[model samples]
Structures are given as structure tokens and as C-alpha cells.
Target: MATYNLNDIVLGVDIGGSHITAAIINLKEKKEIKSTWNRNLINAKGTSHQILQGWASTILQSMESVETKPEKIRIAMPGPMDYETGICLIQDQDKFRSLYSLNIKELLAAEIGYDPADISFHNDAACFLKGELYGGSLYGFDKAIGLTLGTGLGTSYTSSGKAEDADLWNMGFLEGIAEDYISTRWFVKRFYELTGKQVADVKELIDNHAGSTDFYQVFSEFSNNLASFIYQFIQRETPLAAVIGGNIAHADTYFMKETQQELNELLGYSFPVKKSFLGESAILLGAGAST
Candidate 1:
């Protein structure tokens, strides 16, 4: 079995819309201890106690897996949240609504028998970019954008090694907002509109309808919409590059190349749009590095 020095390790946790993932990370090595990683499904609509206990249990499992206590725990959470104070202000987002206005750090610390000072929170989108900037695809870039394409669109911008949420999910695009056109819901909605059938997500659409013209049509439209969004984002941020992550990015083969082509045409120059190199580990590494 692998052994770790407590001083060299920290616990990194990522709370998503429907799950929580925890892992021990070796800060010096900038990598996750895969053996210590734990993920558990969570009911976002549950009571605060249920949600908190679920998170605590998963974190404790990770610690037990590693057989050692970590020096600290850092969480990557969705917002509107007060990262500095570790308070959750999320509301009307259809997730974590039960946690509104709660002191997450104190509650989590109490559940896990740790000092409140030992726990910290960060915006999930920023964490994704910070992870890339730390040791993944965006390593050498001083300025870049990160987009997480999944249940909801997550956006972040990084400059000089610091990342902040871009909060562009609701930004106006086409007739609605950027997310309305670029997110997983768009694919489901579009496919259903075309065929009067329902798909759970992008993967199912691709897997089951790979040969359907409607499948290719949906991707083509999505690619153009994504490129248009990126063009505007680049104009505002002028990032050196952009890294795409999240569950939907797994379908990059269908949209990435076309998105790049459309973006180049729109900009009259080539721009870098790379796939996430770190995958889910990016959040764990980012949380650990922040600590």
C-alpha cells in the first residue's frame, strides 16, 4: 500500500448538482491519490441535514481510504456562494436550494470533527480553470477561458494564474441565453423537436442516433452556436486560449472541429480551443492547489 505524509496531503472535494466527489491529493506532486477517491450520488432537493451528512460521509470515506488525516479540506462548489466566508447563497437554481444562507464551512467542519478554519470553499467554475492553469492544458498560458458544458454551462476566465467565474451562462445569445443554445438541454430539446422523441443526454443521442441525419444536424447547429458564443467571449476577454470540460465535452468529436472552423472564420484567424486534459481530476487538483 502507498503511504503519505499528512503534511504533504490535503483533501479536495467537488460538489456537483447531483453528486459529491472527494479525494486525497499530494500537493507537492500535484496529483490525486486515486486509491483515496470517493464519489457519491446526492439528492440536491433533500433537506440540508441530508445533504450535509452525505457530503461528510463521502469525505470521511476518502480519508479512511487513505488511512490518514489530511492537513486541510478544500471544496469546489457551485455559486451564488460566499467563497471567502464559506456561506452558501444559492437559490432558485434547482440545486442546493436547501443550503441557502448557510455557513457551509462550519457545518461541514462540525460534521467531520475539524476546525472551521481547516475548510475552505471555492467557485466550481474557477476551480476548473485553476486546475488547468496549475498543471493541465492551460499550464503556460497567462490568460485563458474555461468552459464546462453539461447540465448547466459553467464559464471561467484566468489571468496571471488567478481564475474567476465568468458568469456568462445567462448572457444573452440568439433569442434566449448562451446556455439555451449550447447546453445539454439544447440537444435534447432540438432532437425532440426534430423527431418527437426524447433523449436523456448528448451521449444517448450520439450513441443511439449516430447514423441519423437529425443527429448530425443537431451537432452542426450546436457547433455554430458554440462558435458564436466563443467569438463574443474572445472579443470581451481576448484570452490566449480556451479549454472545454464537463460531460458534454466527451462529444467533442462531433462539434469541436466544426466549432473551431466556424470560430476561425468568424475571427478571420485561428484561435485555440483545446479539450480538458485533466478531466474530473482537475477539480480535485485545483481544490488542493488552492489550499
Candidate 2:
């Protein structure tokens, strides 16, 4: 099949546990194209099955207002999915348990009145890498990795201007991979147990008290673990640099700089750490780029 052309209007959806964010992308522009969204989040609130109906209805309705049928509708969902099979391949229930039991592509296409051939699927972090490379911060970088240190550690690797599935989640990265140590859930749980304080968000912890005893410990430990993997990657794939994104990269003072510093200290090599060029719309934009 011929890839969707630069002139086509592709719709991208960033399906998170909290909300389904959507965008209408004109590939010809390659920058910020038209986009909008609905704010109702169901699955994160334990209404996992309901999210399918909610998203299908909301996305199709929203697409109508764009005045474009979108030659392609590309979606970014949680990891462990089979892109070839066009089905979610879930291994755990941290989120999207209902999707774990559904053939998401068929269900979505049947309900949305679109042919399966008109859609594309990618893990969310892989989508992030595509967005970053094709439209965001790493626009000119030849090779890079996009690491999303969000609720879990979302990771993607890119080379030669294309994206790939490298879901390093809990895969024993360094000591034990992402999600095992350095995620918001993990940090916040450690914070609650260590400080006995009811923190609102994990960013708040890094923002307000990064210098504190607890965050200092976790931050360094996480950085060190990340560095070991970076050093090994240097010995193996050796990409030019790595771009860190998602909610955690906002704490550049905590992880981004430190991650790079550790890379240098541990490996005697230097590489820049870039923040995601696109903001909240990155994953959707990237998914659109993939389509």
C-alpha cells in the first residue's frame, strides 16, 4: 500500500488512561496543525469498558467538526500491543484492563464506521518518538530515543527517521527497568511511605522538594539506573542523543540534566538531553505522522 501522502489529512488520537486527546493533522504543514479534544475521562476512573463507547462517539463527533474525513485515523494506546495483528497485547492491569479483553481495532472500526485498512496503531511512547522526530524537538536529529517518564516509564527508539517498538517497561533495565523504580506511581508511593505526606501530584514532589532528602535519594537512584542502560545503549545502538518527554521531563532540574550528567560521568561521553518540542499534543501529532 502506498503511504498516506503529505497532502492527506490524518487524525491522531492519544489514548491515555485519563483522557482521549485528538488532533487533525495536515502532513503538508508538518508543524502544529488543527486540533481539538473532549475532556471527559472514563477509563482512569475505573470505567474501562465504557471508555470504548465514549471515545468512539466523542472522536467521530469531533472529527465531523474538522470538515475532513481524515484519510487515516492513527491511534496511540498503551504498550504490549501487536501492530501487525491490530490488537492490543496487554500483559498487566495497571491500566486499560477492559481493552485487555477486546480486539481494539475491530471494535473501534466497527463502531466508528471506518474500514480497518484506514487505521494505524502504535504504542503511545512510539507515537511520542514519531511526533518528536517528525514535528517536535528532535526535528533534525538523525538518531534519538524518546523516554516518557510518566505514570510509567514510556520508552521509544528512533533511527533513520523512523520509530520502533522498544517497550523497556519493567524489562529489567539496568537493575530493573522503568515502571519498576522511576515512575510517578512508584515515586509517589515511595513518597507517601517515606514522608507520610499526601502529595497531590508527582511533579509537585520534584518541583517543590527535589532538594529534599527523599526525592534526592530516588532521583539519583533513578538517574543511575537510567545511566547504566544509557551506557549499555551507547555500547550497542549508540544513538546521537536522547530526548526525554512527558510529565516528568518537566522536572529538567531533577532528571533531564542529571540523566545527561550521569551519561557523561559513567561513560566518559557527552550527549544533549532535549525536552519534547511539542507539548500535550505530541503523541497525537506523532500518531498522525505515523499514519
Candidate 3:
């Protein structure tokens, strides 16, 4: 077994709709121990035992990759979860329905043989921003906003070293809510409406339709919609900068420039917007730092 400085080591986990990713992070170094990173695909609709076990298994895999046991385990999880009490309140989200109202911290601690106090949960969006604020793109900013664009949209705000969920996903927008027009579902739905074709997600759309006229049109509309939403966000928070992450952000070439330009036109000035420098690692680093 290799010797490690255990005091600085922590297990950081990010639980998404279809997968769980975990790694050992060195808080003193503000980075993940890359060799210990582990990810596992999970069925969100599975029974509670299956989901919890899958998560626990992946976490254990990461923890066991190194000789030292981490000081604590921190998780970046999607909400309507009670972060303080560790109960999941998610329902009607088409994912994790089996976990509704379950106490994840206690259940996961039992699976991993840790005291419940050793485990903690936080909003994934806030964690993402916190990661950026700590050592990524938003590092130097005193106030910033973060957007995670994937299966769903996540928003967070930070100021004076504190980060919290902005909870803007359900905010009212054009026809329904902000997420209805800003997330992966919007890309899939809009692409189908324009071309009568199906795409599993943004990557599929980009892979199958890159450079096509319909592709340009779809992203153009997306740029406008994103700009409109950011306009509202800025009006409310007045953040010094904004950082974006998640799977869909990988295609920033398609929409970022136009979105920035549109937002500038709306606000009558250049606002700082940046792509996430740490990618998925931001969640892990953020979760670990919170510990």
C-alpha cells in the first residue's frame, strides 16, 4: 500500500440522472487524484436499493483505489433534496423517482460502513460554481453565476465566497418554465420540430446535423433563448461573471458566440461569460472542498 496524507484526502461524488462519478480529491492541492477517479452507469428508475448500491459501489471503487481512507465523503446531487437532512424530495422529474423522500446520507453510509456524520450532500449546481470559484474559471471573481446545461438546467449564484442554488429551473419563461426552453430536451424537441427527426441529446444533434442549415437554425434559436434567460438572470443577481458547464456545453462553438452577442445587445455592454475549465472535475473538487 502506498502512503498518503490522509488529512487532505476526501471522496467526492457527483450523482447525475444516469451515472455516478466519484474520485479522491486532495483539498490541500485543490484537485482530484486522477488515478482514483471512477464512474458507473446507473438506472435512475431502478429500485432504491439498486440506485444506492450502484452509487456506493462506485464510491468504494474510488476510495479503494488509494491506500488512505478519505476523511469524509461529500456528494454533489440534484435536487429537490434536503441538503441539510439528506432526504431526497425529488418527484415528477422522470428520474430518481424511487428515491423520493429517502434519506440518502444514512442509506449510503450504511452501504459504505461509514458513520452517517461522515457523509454530506449538496446541490450539484452550487458545487459546480463552488468548484469554479475555488480554482477554475471563476476563481478570481468575487461574484458569479454558474449554469450547468445537461439533461436538465442547473443554476447557482455565488458572492463573497458563498455559493447557493439559484433555483431558477422552474422560473416562469415564455410558455412553460426556464428549463423547458434551455435544456437538452429543448434541443431534441426543437430539432424534431424543425426536421421531424429524433436525437437522443445535443451530442447526437451536433454529430448528425453539424453544418446543415437546420443545424444553424436550431442553434440560432437556442442562442436567442439563452440570451433572453441570461438577461433575466443578470437583472436579478448582477453577478460579476458567469461560467457554464455540463455535457451540452461541450458544443459551445455552436451557440456561445451568438448567445454572448445577443446578451450584449440586450444589456448594452459586454458581460463576462466563460466555459468551465475543469469540466466534470469541478463537481468533484467542489464536493471535496465543501468537506
Candidate 4:
């Protein structure tokens, strides 16, 4: 290992079910190198080679935007993956099936130009919470929880400034698991049941029907469902604050207030519920926090 300046750069990659975003970061400054953020859509259902190609292409583009090569690369990868060993087990998840049991670190390093030892991995959900704990909404809190409400539900908890996976997405809820009511599929299903029209995602519905009664009703139900889930989590974990992220959180204005109100009534007091300030780059920064 060689010593470097505090401002030395590292590459951070945030991989999701649909895309991979790569950025160059100045670790000490906690900021991304200007113009170095690059992203590419990945076909989650594609073959292993195609998926790896997408990651390599986007990462190379990000690397090209900077003048110097990075000493390390930290990846925020989605599960089920082995973060410590770098094995990818994304089986039966409708994505990355071909890469099941693959050693991602070795594969990615072979696909790109980095030593396997120079790369590290963390769970995407855990990184999300870690980012908030490191520099985003959960700063200064001794304990916190994070939720990512996207294609699926992601939960994590942090205490003493370190984050870990909570894995509460499958915890028992109403008719099924918490994820059944709190995920993208749930929103789409509920919205279709309410309006008899189908929309691709939560953003589409929010964008197309901002002021409609049905839209408001749909979001109201969403807020309640989310609040109920949060109540369960809070009672169990007892964190100081809860930070919500992911694509559905992009429409915070539509459901946040109601969720807060519901929590207030349920808890008999106000609890801090924050929107993710770092947006898409949170997990990227979190993945590189240890660098």
C-alpha cells in the first residue's frame, strides 16, 4: 500500500437494477470530481457479459472525464451479493441471473484495468444509509434508519456512525410482507386498481396527475402504508431519525406531509423524517467512504 494526499481521487460506482453510475470522488473533500459522473442503462435481464460490459463502459467513461487514474474503486452493489468475498448471487431476481455464483470482483477487474485488490464492495442499501450517516440527512445522529422505496423496498440501520443491513423488507405486514405494500409494484398495482389506467411508474403518475383527486387518494394510501411500515421499524429499532430515498421518494411532495402527519398521530409526537439530500450519488459516496 502507498500513502497519498488527502485529496487523492477514487472512483465510486453505484449499481442498481436498471443502471450503473460511476463517478470520480475527492475523498477528503467528500465531493465528486467535476464532470466525472457517467451513467449507463443496464439490461438487468441481459447476459452476464452484457451486464459487465455496461458497467465497464460507464466506469470507463467516468474515468476518462478525469485527468488522473484512481487508486481504488468502491462499488455499491445490490444484493443478493457477498460484499466481503465479492461473489454475485443475484439469482431468481429477474436480473443478473447469468452472473449467479460469479466472483464479481474478479470478473469486473478482468473486464476493466484494475487490480482485484484495489476494488471493494458494499451493499447498495447499506451504502445508502451509510451515505446519509456520513454526510447527508442522518449526520450527527447516534442512531438512524434508511428506507429506499424503489423497485423493491430496502431497509438499513445505523448506530454509532456505522450502517448495516436491516433486511426488514420481508418482515410480516398486512397480507404479505412489508415490500408487498411499499414497493414500486405496489404503487402500480394500487394506482391501476384506483383509476383503471396503467402507468409505468410512480413518477409517471405524479407527473401526469399532479392535482387529481384520485392521485391524492392514491398517495394518501401510500403514505399510510409507508407510515405503518415505519411504525413497525421504529418500534423495533428505535432510531433517532428515518431517511427515505429511492425513485418514489423523488415525489416526496405528494406523500411526505401525509406520512409525517400519520406518524405524528401514531407516535403521539413528531419524528424526523427526511428526504435524501444526496439523491442518486448517495450510495456512490458511501461506497467510497472507507477509501
Index of the highest-lDDT prediction = 3
Number of clashes in every candidate structure? Answer: 0, 1, 0, 0
Q: For candidate 1, lDDT tens digit of each residue in 1-291?
A: 467888889999988887899999998788998889999989888999999999999999998865568879999987788998988988856678899999989999999999999899988888999998888998999999999887778899976568989989889999998878878889999999999999988989988999789999999999999999999999999999999998899999999999999999999999999999998888888888885
**What digit string (tens of lDDT, one per residue) describes model 2 on residues 1-291?**
123343667777877656677767666776434444543554554554576787787678556655546767888877777875677766473667667656778778888999888877888888888888876788888788777777667777875667875767766654445576767776777678878876655668866776788878777776776676666655655678777777777766766667778888887767766788786677877887774
Q: Tell me model 3's lDDT, rounded to 2 decimals.
A: 0.91
The global C-alpha lDDT for each of the candidates, from Candidate 1 onward, is: 0.89, 0.71, 0.91, 0.85
What are the C-alpha RMSDs, in order, of all predicted structures? 1.8, 4.0, 1.3, 2.8
Q: In model 4, where do residues sit more than 4 Å from their true spots?
A: 1-7
Lowest-scoring 10 consecutive residues by lDDT in candidate 2? Answer: 31-40
> Any idea what lDDT model 1 has?
0.89
CA lDDT, candidate 4, residue 200? 77
Ten consecutive residues with minimal summed lDDT in candidate 3? 1-10
Better of 1 and 3 by lDDT: 3
Candidate 3 on 251-271: residue-level lDDT in tens? 999999999999999999999
Q: Tell me the lDDT of candidate 4.
A: 0.85
User: Candidate 2 at residue 103, lDDT?
Assistant: 74
